[model samples]
Target: MLTLTEAASRKVAEIMSKQTDPVAGLRVFVQKGGCSGYSYGMSLAPEIGSGDWVGEFGGVKVLVDPESAPVLQGVRIDFVESLQGSGFAIENPNAVRSCGCGNSFETEGTAAEGSLPGEMSV
Candidate 1:
């Protein structure tokens, strides 16, 4: 399962509190696209699905679909503030290669073996 840093957890909780509707948790998923073959996506989920993997960190809930769980395993999310900007950053051990923006990555075997479809070599 993925983990969230203290700053990330705090930021999530803060965002959730400002929402008018009740938030089930933060949903993390992977979709086909990006220069590295896959891009990470996140949103505030309304509820958990039966097949979802649910976990809590620093008092905030996190939801992941089965399809993304394996790819996201051992991932770490942190909130960063810099002179350029402030946003969430992800560190994924399963990613053998990633794009310059860090929002997309390619896992081992999938892209290395030329099995990835419509994915550009980085």
Candidate 2:
């Protein structure tokens, strides 16, 4: 349901390559409490969970928890670098509005509909 651009996938792989511990893949999820009501979070997952939606982009495995699935659907992730900075940028089609930081967003209806109760792992 989610797609990552080549730049994003490459960045993920580059980060995973330097990890000291085992990183099964990247875990992406939505959690409540951002300035715009929800925010995206990511981490190097240690293992895939029973109900996670898994996908591989540019050879980097991406794991999304069931709760975050709907909100993240149709989202496109890209990595960008410029004089300002370099980081993963998320463009979520479902979002009605987003905070200036971009990491936080608000969608139609209640964010609680697809947001995790708290920050959680895949």
lDDT of 2: 0.86
Residue range 1-122, candidate 1, lDDT tens digits? 99999999999999999999989999988887889888889999999978899989999999998777877889999999999999999999889999997778998856765434333557
lDDT of 2 by residue, 67-121 (tens): 7887888999899999999998888888998888776888885454454433343
TM-score, model 1 to reference: 0.88
Which ranges of candidate 2 are over 4 A from the true structure? 111-122
lDDT of every predicted structure (CA atoms): 0.87, 0.86
Error of 2 at 38 (Å): 0.2
| Total clashes for model 2 | 0
